[model samples]
Target: MGLPWYRVHTVVLNDPGRLLSVHIMHTALVAGWAGSMALYELAVFDPSDPVLDPMWRQGMFVIPFMTRLGITNSWGGWSITGGTITNPGIWSYEGVAGAHIVFSGLCFLAAIWHWVYWDLEIFCDERTGKPSLDLPKIFGIHLFLSGVACFGFGAFHVTGLYGPGIWVSDPYGLTGRVQSVNPAWGVEGFDPFVPGGIASHHIAAGTLGILAGLFHLSVRPPQRLYKGLRMGNIETVLSSSIAAVFFAAFVVAGTMWYGSATTPIELFGPTRYQWDQGYFQQEIYRRVGAGLAENQSLSEAWSKIPEKLAFYDYIGNNPAKGGLFRAGSMDNGDGIAVGWLGHPIFRDKEGRELFVRRMPTFFETFPVVLVDGDGIVRADVPFRRAESKYSVE
Candidate 1:
């Protein structure tokens, strides 16, 4: 009843050459991705309209697949006969920061994978025959070093060491501070700096990865240990199930405790507010009237409004302007939420102005309207403000 000779061959869990190949491959792919992103960030980034920027909006290798599945679309606007129409859906700063964190995460994971493979190869070699190096000790040292890097990166994001104005939002009014959004203000901390959050996740995963690697290095059980543990045993099954249940309970308890805790504004900067649609509408109306009196088109006047708001946002959110840090020091939030107004305006079939209240849910056709030579709202489109409310708890 014994197994056949060919079937009894040992399964090779670790091969030095194969592991080295995988490590090289992983490094190459990660490096390539990082390089492409760097090029886009530095040489190709366009601050004025990042959505239309070739560098910022360029998709990775997998983007085509996503686009085919109707998951993503080109982030740009259309040009009409009178003026250019920009896509209101795209937010440049948010998009860039998001891409950075995502790529950084991929590289982090690759590093961990390489380390694991190296450790495994060393472990297999040591167990099979005598190796010159102290593999276990070396593996532990590597784990410690990797853990430090992960911790440092995580701390950097948490402290906003990279740049000022990189803050998180606290909608529950946990953080008593408020941020200015150009002509108005709203609650901050709704969206945090992406890198900071990514760093935290990386640190957690890295810690677990290192721990598992170290545990394997420290505990090299003999073949007898595997033989003694019978999978089909009722006692073994009961013990494993009990341990799983306890672990699940611990996770649930920890999540609930964290949720109930007060918002940590100190760890992540204080919450800031932004200008709502009402304020933006008032400003727009004034500016548009002035432009009309001067014989300027609505598109031309509206175009300058964003630029003006952006300048104001910079001044208000600048850490030097009595923010969280000192005047000379740079310690402000990312200011992405400040300068620009949300909501895109379109035209109806009858040439009436249509302001989108919220983000578009699906593809819907809307007419595009243009102001006539006479400084009048084409089709007498009435101006309206998008509703936004604030409260303190």
Candidate 2:
């Protein structure tokens, strides 16, 4: 009473010309190009530098003329120190690995797209000398599967299971027991760099692609209907409904995964003080003040600086205990420290406080002051620790 599986196979095999259409080839090429671009982006974009900042702050780009907005608060600053001057921090292998997995999924979807297009096109039946089953009517089902595969790959990659390394060795460990592979990159806590966060956009995009494919299939007519209502029409509606249900499920599942995977780790020790706006503003004033007070040129200050302060461990250690003391030498070889009073309270004999109103050029390269050995700032100042040279090598 029902059509058997062999009949379906016979229908597909009999229509050889349908397997190679101009439209199918074009769609395959487009899908392939998209997949290639995804891989290219993953390879060239270093997450530590300015190139990857845009992706991290996805929607911040449209504010017009605020292109460098993402870099304003030193968000693009090097996460680690050591290595050559050109490479200050360790490369983010997690990001690279995640990108590769997402790209693989895209490639898989592209291949599936080709297969669906090739097999679903209308073709004459060799048995009856007429068009047999309307194969294109089932395109929605294949499209839905392709979308699911895309989402699954992205989800798997974000879990760190599919990547070269794991995000956390023991994800279920106690807060203090958990350890990140790289602490310099700050992957220890619940951060956006987690797999779920990175893969979310990819999953959303895949879901939308599936929805579009389903819509396209719904609009295409398999055969003429009686008063525009027939069994084929019912099949199209049912397929679209099933696609919608799957899409909803994916959305819910992705949300749940992200929420659970990104929960913050409660450490046994005091909370680390992350850099914030207030801290930056205070440090800026202090460094500038010291430079102006000493009348030291930037190059002069840089030359006098020691090397210990260049490493992240120097700054990141014991963040909760008042954190690292932020200060930098001015371009004019002067050192500054932020004072509580508006005017420098502890002024030199010349009435100059250890504060500067203006910042020097190349301030980022200015030496970070670990300690103020002498009460008064001077060009030949003694620093407990300093980073005079670039940490590239």
After superposition, candidate 1 runs with Cα above 4 Å error: 1-14, 40-146, 156-214, 220-360, 367-393
- Tens-place lDDT per residue, model 1, 199-249, is 455456567756766775687545576347643233454466579779978
| lDDT, residue 73, model 2 | 15
lDDT of 2 by residue, 1-393 (tens): 666974443333434444333334545565455445544544443334221122222211111111111111112343212112333222232233344456556555655565565543345556666644444445566677777776664554443345322223123212111222221223433354353343554466568768966875777654565335553443454567679889988865554334333222111111123122233334444565577679986545434332211111122222222214533211112212221222222334454444322212223333322223343333322233253331211
Q: RMSD in angstroms, candidate 1?
A: 17.4
State candidate 2's TM-score.
Answer: 0.28
Task: Specify the poorest-scoring 10-residue window by lDDT in model 1.
Answer: 176-185
Alpha carbon deviation, residue 46, candidate 1 (Å)? 4.3
**Collision count for each candidate, in order:** 16, 21
